[model samples]
Target: MALKFHIVNRIREQVKAQGDKTALRFQTAKGWGDISWRQFGQRIDDISRAMLVSGLAVQDKIAIFANNCPEWTITDMAALQIRCVPVPIYPTNTPDQTAYILKDAGARVLFVGDQTHADIAMSIAEQCPALEHIISFNENVDFAGHPMGMSWEAFMALGNDNVEQELQTRIADAAMDDLTTLIYTSGTTGEPKGVMLDYANFAAQLESHDKVLSISENEVSLAFLPLSHVFERCWTLFVLHNGATNCYLSNTNAVREALQEVQPTVMCAVPRFYEKIYSAVHEKVATANPVKKGMFHAAVTIGNKMATSIQQGKKPSALLQASYRMADKLVLSKLRQLLGGQIKMMPCGGAKLEPTIGRFFHAIGINVKLGYGMTETTATVSCWDSATFDADSIGLAMPGAQVKIGKNNEILVRGPMVMRGYFNKPKETAETFTEDGYLKTGDAGHIDAAGNLFITDRIKELMKTSGGKYIAPQVIEGKLGKDHFIEQIAVVADARHFVSALVVPCFETLEGWAKELNIKYHDRMDLIKHSDVVEMFEKRITELQKELAKFEQVKKFTLLPSEFSMTNGELTPTLKLRRKVILERYKKQIEAMYKKHM
Candidate 1:
């Protein structure tokens, strides 16, 4: 199929075709508000002019340190319009981490979301000599009367008719190889690396998605994932390219409420989102009466049968079809309503999703497209097909992408969407690619005969016991994490005598169970340490790991009162576990688990 979209001039095209249509939607103090395509295009032009007036040259780096909001995308699209590279800093980044990226990228202008981000940028402004301006999206941000700081409105007012011609020229000069963005990878170890993505990279993503997914101007996409992440960033552009209304969600804690209000037809999310929903549903079912529990299971079974038949290209029997319709009306539809019933498709990635959870969503009417990609590959390289859904596989390689297994079973990819290189790191960039030109994904996986990709584990994360049994910790964690009581788990077995784990329980569920049993505790720490609580977790862990190999099962565990968080540096911005940090942080607890065995 011919490419229907390209990121370079997508906004202008959308504006000309549908000027009055809603291009953006955001939550306001009163309620929801909309921005038309005409307004969206005008804002981009104004920002582009402002950059030119500020003396920003082509490809000068502009940093955006913000949560998801309309201003974030406006700034990003604006920077692109003038051929400038927009570098995104995760909103949760620390002052030190923020300084590293600004200094490394040599950003000329910084855009911040709230007072917190503004203060962090201001604190590090002197450290980054290249930074000349800081614009705050939140007008209420306290700039302390800093000369270099200004509100977004004031910055936009700097644009004039004199710079209008220059802005137009820059937009017209857009090229395929122009550097589009510099996304810093949230590395689990060492400093983060800047991944350079170009117009060609995102163009390839638009084209590939056009072939695999069906999106139109009428579709409503909820932008909940951090736009700083590659998946959501690219998907947001695609949504605009299709002239769809893109809803901006600033606070992640309000996602449930936003979903109900927006009723988005499409959205991009991580596997954790789906896992949490799956766990919540199962948790409620676990406490229900026998009849309700039986009905829920029976409904899921019927839905699964119908889903399986369709996946295998067979029509369901008439009786089966009738049964599925009944199940959908009574049970499955209610499950979907939790996500806002209008969902047509949800693209899930960023971590391994348990196959059972993937199957569960598929059994319902909701279509979860579990794809695979990275900051190195402008978002998606593979995703589920509507005609042949395979919950266990990552579907086929995208239309213009090539995937193969290299030495160590690492998944290697070469495609238009693959990144150019790590910005300013020639040696590291050279090390990332094979001589034949495939980007080494550093993930171990295999391709089935039918061209489906199945990821086993991150090669670097694989753990081996002292007895030499290799264990994929993610597989074990994915299984146990499905239990509603377990919130987070990190398997510890590398060069150790036996497998062990540090688990953080779902406190709400655990506390409710404790109350039901009439157990008393002083606090979360006391609750977790209580004999009854410990015994219950022990029993649940044993049952959850029954399918795992004997050597891979978690033999000993330490329960933590708190969930791993970005603030504590235990997790990366994308929420991937920083195992080294986790290991060091809980050294005492980890050592306790192996002290007797040692």
Candidate 2:
């Protein structure tokens, strides 16, 4: 169905119907605070009026350089209400990257979260000639030396009776084709391009999600991921559209504590979140006594059986049902409590989630909805249905989204959710699509008999060894990365004769193991170089890769003291590996691994 109403009108309808009910929840100096629908509407209107007063015309680009916060969404909705395009800059982006986006998008106003963001904008404000106003979300942000800087409070107060008519006219003129947002892709290869998404794209998402997800006004979503990314940003809009409350989590490190405090019914997360949890749980389980360990394994086995039966549309036998109840009480229930015991659904994406991790979550009664998409697709091209369970596939294609294999097994998509094109890059945009108009996803995948999409690997990222063996690095990385001892792994096989990796150990678990083994070291580097530590990793890697082909196994590895990070240019904002950067950064270590063999 086509979008019948503009997003602003939908939000306005919710405000009138659900006034006094909480619409946004955010952290405060004391504790969690709530914003009623009435307040939310008022803030959005006020911000809209402020934009008009500040001389922002229709189609003007406004940038939000902030972490996940209530103000971030408020600003985004405000921009939509006034027909301005909201361009999000990842909070973790370097100054040069931020400046590039601001300049590329021609953003006139930049909204910053805190002093750090304000400083970044201030430093690059001159570099972006189009950037005029700097609005600070934090009241304490000192706009000391900047001429066009002001706190959010001051910015809101700029609106008055004068601009009310202009705001109303802008709202009344909102259209489905109106540009909603320009989300710059965190490119692993080259310069970032703005993906131009319109209101139609999001409206299709809202319509599609209605058919697949079971969510309502009663649901509470923990906004754990960065609001800058399309996955979290799109989910937040859907949550607010359903009159559900969204709890913003600015600091990602505090997610565990926030999950417990919020007790959210629904949340969106990446695969790494589950991977870490899976690894930690197993690490603990490995240290348990033999009796406890055996009992845990038995419970998981029963739970998996029950889950599989349900997925297959078969009623569990009475004996199986009874066994599942016992397992739930003995093991699964405790595991649920770790995630606050209220996660009805968790939409997992951004990368391939290992099948083992997917099955483990299902066994513990956590609904981890594995899905696929990209920034160009405005998030989900496909997602798991509540009753559908596929450990090896990324579920069925989303409603209204047509997915088919194109040349070289590339996944091609044609849907309302796909972006119009990359902003101001007509040549690149033309190259991104086929003659038949399908968006070239650049991902190699195939559809099974059940119509489920199974992703193989990124076509561009496939590595070819000197011996003429082609390898999918992600497949190898996903397998070995599940081991409790391995925190992160970057497979190194391109142009080399054998597979090798740079491994980062789970420091907390490794420390405990080292202590038990009476191993001593001075620092992280020293600890990673310890002979016992090397042997432990070698053994774990062997066990993890037992199912893999001989050519796919890691022949050798170098233990790293640190995990790849965004600040170091080793990872993108969405936690995708920047393989080129990683390869260049650790050139010496990668060379050492293949030195003897080559």
Candidate 3:
């Protein structure tokens, strides 16, 4: 068991015992590297010792503005090991967003990942009074030219790097009750606020899942998920506590190749990854040989049948059993082989995955367990217990989590993993906390008889009509998103009246349709305005309307020329839609589309 002591102590203990075991790996531009626990721990020790010598005291906040790398976790462990708070800034965060978080958190030391991070931080260093020093995680990108700092290796040399006993003493100073990490959330309502979490939240979450999930010691996880995000952070703890080695993806673009080389036993990722894989397969099959396509289609059919039987708790029939074996051998098996066939399970989170996708993977013998949660919930609420998973539902609540629907159907969450209120915003914090102390998740959801939580909508996202009929736009929007052509959507229903949708078609999906129809376009803007593409969306909208209530149907719609972008302030860095911005930007266009005379 990891030291229920602060998160840092857990890493210390893991290193002490699992010295030779691989703790971290990185898919470099050159190739893959396997770093041992002892070396990983030594890097943490050197950083913490250097900081200590430099007068970084307990509770000091250190900010990391870097991409996914082995050094990110090394930095994380260094802070927690010393009972200090580490604030992780999103690697792709705008300079404006980066400034606000660093200044507000009063970060003392900053680890800038690359020139991109260094440039942004350097630009804003004048305004951030608390930032004392910057360390470069990259060697080639020297910081000697900068006014604030130096290279990472030089920073480490400032400490007594060989002080093993001093390292132990520093970790001993750590406490589970001490502040460990501060996650600043980019909330929908207002400015982002820091979420102060102690060792308890991380320990409670990692330990709870350990007992429930029992990942074996030698299991490997290919982690490309943003370490700044709680989903990956908690999963990293899961890997660390289980004695599993965590490999970092070189970049998002390197994910496919990394998967082939590493062939990790388990993967924790968002729904989009699976969606891309599914889409790529669909695209490939479109041009594959007739025999191969037929075989692939037949394999999917068998997998679907097997998935249904498993979900229903029945064994496959003799005919299906034989067919599945054949499919596995001929078609589906090669797909698994590409992933190294060690893919025992996939935990898909960050958004609701289509149940059909889950069923399809399960049918083909991959366990894609559907889980649900938010940043406020410390990122894990429910996960499909592989032992008793129901593909359609968002699994059962993780151990020790309480889910109760409140007065207006808001999902009230109470658990050890629940975050301390948003940093420095009591009024907002008070509003999110119930009188009885449950965290008001702002999500509309209900618990089933079997203890599964099915989220339906957001309380703040409902659209009401003149007659007082109200509808949750997210429900309809999510369903509409399932249509391959609909890439981005904003179901606008703010104070005005009835519902309408602002749709952005997946350019690839729409372009495929446009090609099939012998239509040509120069770009997304050109394609969106094309009568052929607009007509395609119109048909899709009409089809989905059949699934909606009369009052809830989207009466008028507009196909947007360009999708929402982070730079333009249309999406959260996590890539969630900012409805208010979308509503404001497209109001004029939407009004034109909605004119009764038009």
Estimate TM-scores for all models: 0.99, 0.99, 0.93
Regions of model 2 farther than 4 Å from truth:
1-5
Per-residue lDDT over 280-323 for candidate 3, one digit per residue giving the tens place of the 0 to 100 score? 66667776899999999999998878877777789889999999
Predictions in order: lDDT: 0.92, 0.92, 0.79
lDDT of 1 by residue, 1-598 (tens): 1223547577788899998989999999998999999999889888888889999999999999999999999999999989999999999999999999999999999999999999888888899999999999999998998878999999999999998888889887888888999999998898899999988888888878888889999999999999999989999999998889999999999999999999999999998899899999999999999999998999999988988898899989999999999999999999999999999999998988899999999888789999999999998888888768578787789899999999999999998989999988999999999999999998999999889999999999999889999999999999998889999999999999899999999999999999999999999999999998999999999998998889999999999999999999999999999999999999999998898777
What's the CA error at residue 17 for candidate 1, in Å?
A: 1.0
Error of 1 at 123 (Å): 0.7
Of candidates 3 and 1, the better by lDDT: 1
In model 3, the number of clashes is 0
Q: What is the lDDT of residue 267 in candidate 3?
A: 83
> What lDDT tens digits, residue by residue, belong to model 2 across residues 1-598?
3445457777998999899999999998898999999999999999998899899999999999999999999999999999999999999999999999999999999999999999999999999999889999999999787997999999999999898888889888878999999999998899999999999988888888888888899999999999999999989988888889999999999998998999999999999899989988898899999998998899999989988998999999999999999999999999988888899999999999999999999999999999999989989999876676589899999999999999999999999999999999999999999999999999999999988999989999989989899899999999999888888899998889899999999898899899998898999999999988898889989999998999989999999999999989999998889999999999999988777776
